[model samples]
Every structure is written in C-alpha cells, then in structure tokens.
Target: MTSVDLHLEEQSMVVEEDEFREGEVPKRKNKKKRSHADLGEDAEKRGICYLSRIPPHMNPSHIRQILSRFGDIHRIYLVPEDPNIQVHREQASGFRGKEFSEGWVEFSKRSVAKRVANLLNGEQIGGKKRSSFYYDIWNIKYLRKFKWDDLTSEIANKNRIREQKLNMEISAAKRERDFYLSKVEQSRALNFMQERRKKKQKTVGAESDGTEEPKVIRQFPQNRPVADGGAQTKTKLSKDILAGVFGGGS
Candidate 1:
C-alpha cells in the first residue's frame, strides 16, 4: 500500500477513537445526572410507618409478606424484645421463638404507607384460626416528616450510650472487687501479726516461769529496857568511886 494511503487510514482511526471517547463522556454524564434525579425523587416519595406492638413470632419477613400486598416495602426494622423478658416468657410458656416488641417499616411511596397505617390500625389480623397471630391487633401509625436516616441515627446514638454505661459499670465492679480483695489481705495480715505476738508472749512466760525462782524477805527482833532498881544501884556505885578518888567533898 502507498505511504500516503497508510497515513490517511491512521488519521481516520484517531478521529474515530476521539469521537467514541466524546460519545462515552456524555453518556456517562447523563447517567450520573439521571441517577441523582432519581435519588431525589425517591427520597421525596419514601415514607415510614410505626408499629407500636409487634405480634409474637412475627419476624421482618412475615411482616413484609403481609404488608407487601398493599404496596412495595423498601425496608423493615423490628426491635427485638428485651432478652430478660424473653427469657422469662420462654421459661413460663415453654415456647421459644424470636419476638419483636416494636417495629418500623419503610415504603416506596408516602401515600401507600399512610393508607396501610389507616387500614390496619386497630384491626384484627384475620387469618387461619391456627395461626398464632390471627387474633393479634395491629397498632400501626404513619409517622409524618420522619425519615429512615433519623431512625438509624437515633439507634446509633442509643447504642453509643449503652456501650458507655456498660463500660462504666464494668469499671465500677472492678474497683469494688479490688477494694474487697485489699481489705481481705489486710485482715489476714492483721490476724497473722496478732497470732505471732500471742505466741511470743506465751514463749516468754514459759521461759521466765521455768528458769527463775521466788524471792524471800528477812525479819529482825526488837530490844527491851532495864528495870529501875538496877539502874539506881549502878548510879550509887559510880558516885562512891568518884568521892574516894577526890579524898572528900567539903
């Protein structure tokens, strides 16, 4: 083939690639814009309903089956019964199944949600007599100006608070247990010291009683006085001697 013809074919291929890219760009942009518009419309039409009391053994799937007859359901969230209460009921009745206390259902259209709430509110759940929830009543209400994001945010905030409280309780329990253990240790140490001191005293008393003897104190007698006549004769003898020595008392 000629070089000029080959060059022309290369140019044509480049132009075609550019045109393809240009076409793809606008298609992608249009898709993004359409998605955004659809999302806005969906948000405006979305509605939420509240169920005050959920019948026992009624799960989200069961609720969807029943409510789907009226309109399309977007989402279902049923708050489970308290674990403590469920345990008590299970023991008393010997029936074990997942139970919900309350629930919230999201519908694709606001009008359908409102209609379902009105129709089902205060109405008996009529079904086969053998159905567990046949006699249960619906306590549904349409929530105005409420959104799914609001429910999710509220649930997240509650979970955060519950986690904080559980952490605080665990810390408090640990502190109390540590304090109790410390007190027990102190009491044990004090008792040990007292026992050692008592033993030391007993040992010292035994040594003193065995090695030492009792001390004795001495006593003396008293002297008596002479008679009066013996005292006078002695004085007369002393006076005669003194007269002989001095040759006379003129």
Candidate 2:
C-alpha cells in the first residue's frame, strides 16, 4: 500500500460566453460526446513509462505532483521488485521499501509520455533547478512496446524458478555430505573390529607357543639316627649322599 493518490488527469474547464444573444439568456456550454471507437483510441494512446532507482520514500502523490506537471497522467503504478516481501504492518516502511528497484508511470497521452521519457532519461530526478521533486533521485526510461503486466509476470516467474533451483542444489549437497560421513563412520567401525580380532589372535598364539620350559621339583631323603657301632648307619640328606646313591644327580 504505497501512499496512493487518485489524481484525475482530465479536469473540467468551464468557459463562459462574453456576448449575449438578443432576448436569450446564456446557457450552459455543451460538451462534445465521444464515440466508442474514439474512446478506444484514447485508451491506446495511454503510454507507460518506467522509472528506475526510485527512492523508497517517493510515493504516488510525490511522483504525480512532479511528473503531472509534464503531462496528464491516467495512473501510476509503483512496482515493488519483491512482491512476496511485506514490510512490517506496525512500521511506516511499507511505502518506503528501498528494495523496490523500479516502477511504471502511465500517462494519459502517448506523446506526452514519450516526451517525458526523452526529456528525463539520464538526468537525475532532482538535478535540475526549480524542479518540484528537488530531493528525489531516479532515472526514467520509456519501455517502447512492453506492457506492465507482461514484464512483471516474467520477472516474478524467473525469481521463483531461480529460488527453487538454489534450494534443490542445497538439498543435494546436504545429502551427499551425509552419505560420505556415513561411509567414513562405517569404515572406522570396521577397522576397529578388525584390530580387536587381530589382537585376540595374537594373544592366543603367544599363549600356545612353547618358548617357556616346564618347572621341575626336587626331593631329598630323610636322615635316620644311628647307635655308634651296630644299630643303624645314618644316611645324609645332601648333594654328595644323593650323588653316591644315584651315581650322579643333576
């Protein structure tokens, strides 16, 4: 809802008669009636002009006040670049969306519209002295043969398609990334299991190896007490005694 002004292009002018007819009072001036074909031709003569880099704060009223001085304007449509975007309702920035990149100004007459286009193109809106819109800044370009609806529709479609393409690409990249990460995790788990199996096998082989020898136990005979001459002779429990008994002990 840009600040809108329903300014009519055609204003009624009443011309009074200077001389009076004898015995006749002055009557209201008769207006000429236009045919249906003539009205159609007039509609056709309404040309559209495009403005770029329009200041966000410049509304329909401001523009009409400035450009109507140039010609009679049927209507002016301020086209926002991003239609889906909405300025906060709580704020006053709706009409001042700097995001609006361009707009369309419709003049009631083709010749005047063309005249404005030629005169204003390349010149800054506020550059010249004594201009009504002294602080306004933008450029004017006449779209020779394009209608507003067609151009706006084409741009909107393109933007929508481009956004969809970008979304698809992002989604694809995420999927690919997730897939690669899963593969890496699986590989790590597999490697860990393989290492554990190899360690267990190494331990079993070490235990089964015959590098260590079996332990041996040695026993000695007990000594018996002897009565000096004839009772019993005492046997010694020593390395020497064992060697005499068994020939040699190792």
Q: Number of the top candidate by lDDT? A: 1
Q: Which ranges of candidate 1 are over 4 A from the true structure?
A: 1-34, 205-250
RMSD of each: 16.8, 16.1
TM-score of each candidate structure, all chains considered together: 0.68, 0.45
Which candidate comes out best when scored by TM-score?
1
lDDT of model 1 at position 18: 51
For candidate 2, report its TM-score. 0.45
Clashes of each: 0, 0
lDDT of 2 by residue, 141-226 (tens): 78776554454466567668978998999999999999999999999999999999999999989977976677799999987755
